[model samples]
Target: MAYKITSQCISCKLCLSVCPTGAIKVVDGNHWIDSELCTNCDGSIHTVPQCKAGCPTADGCVKQPSDYWEGWFANYNRVLAKLTNKQDYWENWRNTYSQKFSEKLQKHQGQVPA
Candidate 1:
């Protein structure tokens, strides 16, 4: 399976330059991996996935099926809060975003469009 960029990405764009297939793209304020083009760095220039290696965040790039987007976002926010000394700000944002996400999930009955 291809690797996916989590919400932990931070939109640093470091992965873009490292990706051999040009699969990573910035969309809607986040950096996303194009699954079709992603090769998990297999049979490419790198032995390890470049995105994962290039990413500064813990678990920023991970195997798709195993990476839960919501959890990743929460973890990312937590780490960001600590790093930036903005715990309160990040916590507030996380709470608001989580609430909105939950509401949307409920409205969709847990079926999110891929």
Candidate 2:
């Protein structure tokens, strides 16, 4: 019954402060919710889930699917390959240049230097 933060999160940290159990955290520049710590605001201070209520972006906070993939890296690679139409190339790119790409993305987002 925990909520999951999607890529749509703007890293605003709104959910971080609002979560009663402090389940939300920033990981690799994305906001993620620790399911073990999440209480879904069922009997907590808030009547509703704080993460979902505080999120600025629509659909940024969503209920964790029952069959959510725990192996995110594998799922990510598969999706990337499908979208780019280059499975091997994308796999290689992710393995070889992901760090550089992340750094560049951070810089572009003004979170780091170019």
Candidate 3:
């Protein structure tokens, strides 16, 4: 199995430095885990890989989209939505992305935001 990184990655550079084989590299000016070099040494190189590990400053240093979504569903997201009263707005926002995957993504993101 190959290791991976997600869009949520904060480009922390932790994974890259922790890699033993230097398989990981930067793409589009962002650090990405290179599967070829992952080594499955998942934890041998560094303690917890340092990406998003216990650092308050890092939001999603290492992310799995499915897991992240599940965790979001678990947390007080529903309550937060009710408090914000922006639920319907976000629903419409999601509908806007109901297009073909790449097209919808392109339409939604004209430029990457920090």
TM-score of each: 0.56, 0.56, 0.39
Q: Could you tell me how far off, in angstroms, the CA of residue 93 lies in candidate 3 after the best superposition?
A: 17
lDDT of 3 by residue, 1-114 (tens): 344565556666666655666767887867666655555557575555444453234233443334666657734564575557865777776766675676868867977785
Per-residue lDDT tens digits for candidate 2, residues 4-111, read: 888778888888888989898886887899999998988886888988987899668877755557546545765776668864776887777988888888778996
Quote model 2's TM-score: 0.56
Candidate 1 residue 57 Cα shift, in angstroms, is 0.2
lDDT of 1: 0.84
* Residue 53 in model 1: lDDT: 89
Q: Give me the displacement of residue 101 in model 3, in angstroms.
A: 31
